[model samples]
Target: MTVYAVVNTKGGVGKTTIAVHLATMLARAGQALLIDGDPQGSAASWAAWRRDGEFSPSPTTTVLLGKAVFNEGKALSQGFDNVVVDAGGRDNGGLRSALLLAQRAVIPVGASNLDAAAMTDLLTVVELAKDYNPDLDVRVLLNRVDPRTKDTAEMLEWLAEQNLAVMDARVCERVAFRRAIGEGATVQEINKKDQAAVSEIEALFKEITQ
Candidate 1:
C-alpha cells in the first residue's frame, strides 16, 4: 500500500484537514485508511462526525487511532490501497514515527512569514528522517492561500528558493473548507456552491498521486 503523511511542526497549518480530505479523495479510487497520529485526535473526530451522519458515510475509508501508530499503521495498511496519517503539529515522536512509515510526506505551510519561518525546523526533521526512509518523497503544500493577496505571491517565491520540493498545486482560502469540516463533509460531498473548492481538492489529489 502507498502511505502518505500530512505533517507539519507548527499547529493550525491544516495538516488534519489535508489528511482527512486526501484520504476521502483516495477512497474514490479504492480502499483507503486514515491513521490519526495526533494526540489532539482531529482526524478521528472527523471520522466520528461522518459516522454520526453529520455527512454522507465514507464507506471506502477506514480510520484507526493509536499512540503507537507507526508499526500498527504499516501492518494495517496491507489491507488497503492507500494509508494517510495525520501526524501532530509538533517536533515530537509522532511526527518522526509517521515519517518512518510514509512513502510521501506533505508539509502544509500557510502564506505568512511565521509559517515560512516554521518550515526550517520542520524541514530539518524531514531531512533527518530521510536518512532512514531514503525513498520518502517530501513536498511542501501551500495552504490557505489567497491569490488576490501579495502574500501569496511572496510565499510562492520564498518556497521556490527553499531546498525542499514544493507542489505546484495550492489550496486557496475558502469558506467551503471550514463549512465542510464543521459539518463533517468532504469537498466532494458538499453542495454545488462549493464546487470550486471541490475542484481544487481534486486537482491536488491528481497532482499528488500522478
Candidate 2:
C-alpha cells in the first residue's frame, strides 16, 4: 500500500537501522518487503541475522541497486502491502531511483553539527528528484538525539524555513539499537523491558505510514 524510502547523503545517520526497524514493524501489520539499495548491504545483513536467529514473521527482503532500484522497486512493490527501501549513504543512482517511486521519503539526520549542515546538500538532491516524484512526502527524522538537549531545535527550525516537515517522532541514541541490530533484532525482540527504544521505533513506523 506504501513505499518508504530512507535516505541521506551522509553516512552514520542510522539510515539502514531505521529502515530495517520500520520494515519489521510494517511486516507485522501487513505483507511487507524491504529493498536494500545500498552497496554496503547492511540492511541485507540484518535480514540474514534475523533469519538466523529464527525470528518469526520477518519482512521479505532483497537487494536492488542503481537504476534497477527504480525499475524493479516498483515491480516488487506490487506483491507486498508495503515496501521499505534503504538507499545508500550518498546521492547516487540508487537513492535517485528510490525517490522516483517512494510514497514517503524519510531523511534521517543525526544530532550533530556536521550531520545537520549536510541537510541542505541532501535536500538539494531531493528537490531535483521532486520533478520525477512530485507526490513524494518528505520528512526529516531527528535520529540519535541527545536526551538532555534534544539539541536539534536550531537545525529543525532552519529546515522548517525551507518548508520541510521534521517528523514529530525522534530517536535517541541508545545501546539497545546497536546491540539489537548487531544480532539482527529489534529492541523489542532483544529486550521487552526496553520500552523507550521500542516505543521510539514504533512511533517512527506510525509517523512514516500516517
Candidate 3:
C-alpha cells in the first residue's frame, strides 16, 4: 500500500479537503482507507454525514482516531492500495507516527502570507520526520492559489529559491471544492469533467508516486 499523509502545522489549510479528494480519487481507481487523526474530527464528521445519506458515496469507510493510533493505521493499510491520512496540526504524536509510517508526505500550502510564513514551522516538522526516515520524500502542494495574484508568483519563486520540491499542479480556490464536504463528494465526483481539479490531483499523485 502507498501511504501518504496530508499534513500542515497550520490549520484551515485545506488538509482535510485534499485528503478526502485524494482518497476518493484513488478509491475510484481501487481500494483506499482514510485515517483521520485530527482532534477536530473533521473527516470523521464528514463520514458521519455520508453515512446519514447527507452526502454522496454514502457509507464510505473512514476511521477517526486520536494521536498515537499509528499501529492501528499501519495494520489497516496492509492490504490497501492507498492509505490517505489526515494528521492533526501541531506536535501531535499521531502526526509524528504518521510521518514515520508514510512513504511520502505532502504539505499543502494556501496562497496567503500567513500560510506562507507557516511553511517554516512545517519545515521543522519535516526535519523532525527526517530524523526517523532520511529517505522520506516530502513535497509541497500549493492549494487555494489565486493565479491572478502576485502572491502566487512571489511565493512560487521564493519556494524555488529555497530549493523546495513543489507539485506542478496548483489547487485553485473554487466554489466546487468549498461545497464538496457538505455534499460528501469530491470535485471530480461532482463533475468528472472538472479538468482543473482532475489535473491538479493527478499531477500531485504522479509527483508523489514517482
Candidate 4:
C-alpha cells in the first residue's frame, strides 16, 4: 500500500480538505484509510459527517486519529490499499511522525506571498525527513488559486523557480469547494453546477497518483 501525508506548516492552507478529498477519491477503487494526525480532528469530523449521512455517495473510507497511529503506519498499510494522513498545521511531533512514514508528502500552499514564505520552514522539515527516508516524494500543491489574478500568475512563476517539485494541476478558488466541504460532501458528490470543481480535483488526483 502507498501512504501519503497532506501537510502544511501554516493553518488555513486546506490540508484537511486535500486529505479528505484524496482519500475519498482513492476509496472509489478500493479500501482507503485516512489518519487524522491533527489534534483539531477536522478530518475525523468529516468522516463522522459522512457516517451520519450528511453526504450522498458516502466515502468508503476509514479514519483513525492520534499520533500513535503514526508509529503503526506499516501495520495499517498492510490492511488498506491507500493511507492518507492529515497532519496538523504546524511544526510538531505529529507532523514529523507522519512525514517519516509517508511515501509522499503533499504540501499545499496558497497563492499569496505569506503562503510562499511560510513554506521555508516546512521545506526544512522535509529535508530533515530525507535523512531517514531518502525515497520520499515531496510535492507542492497550489491551492486556493484564482487564475485571473495577477498574483496567482506570479506565484506560479515563482514556484517554477523553486527547487521543490510542484504539481501541474492547481486547485482554483471556487465556492463549490467551500460548499461541498461545509456540507461534508466530496466534490464528486456535488451537484452538476459544480462540475468544474469536481474536474479540478480529479485532475489533481490523476497527476499526483500517476
Q: Give me the candidate number with maximum TM-score.
A: 2
Tens-place lDDT per residue, model 4, 1-210, is: 788999988999899899989988888777788888777778878888777755643434444444565666657677888888888875387788888889998998898988888878888888898998999999988899877888877777887787878888888888888777765778777665588788889998998888
Better of 1 and 4 by TM-score: 1
Worst 10 residues of 4 by lDDT: 56-65
lDDT of 2 by residue, 85-196 (tens): 9999653899989898798999999777687677777888899989877898999999888878746877687777889899999999988999989888888899554789
| Per-prediction TM-score | 0.92, 0.95, 0.88, 0.91
lDDT of 1 by residue, 156-185 (tens): 788889876888888988888887776667
Candidate 2's displacement at residue 210, Å, is 1.8
Off by over 4 Å in 4: 54-69
Winner of 1 and 2 under TM-score: 2
The weakest ten consecutive residues by lDDT in model 3 span 53-62
TM-score of 1: 0.92
How high is the CA lDDT of each candidate model? 0.81, 0.88, 0.76, 0.81
Candidate 3 lDDT tens digits, 4-68 = 88888888888888888777777766778888878788888777765665444332455545444
| Runs off by more than 4 Å, candidate 2 | none
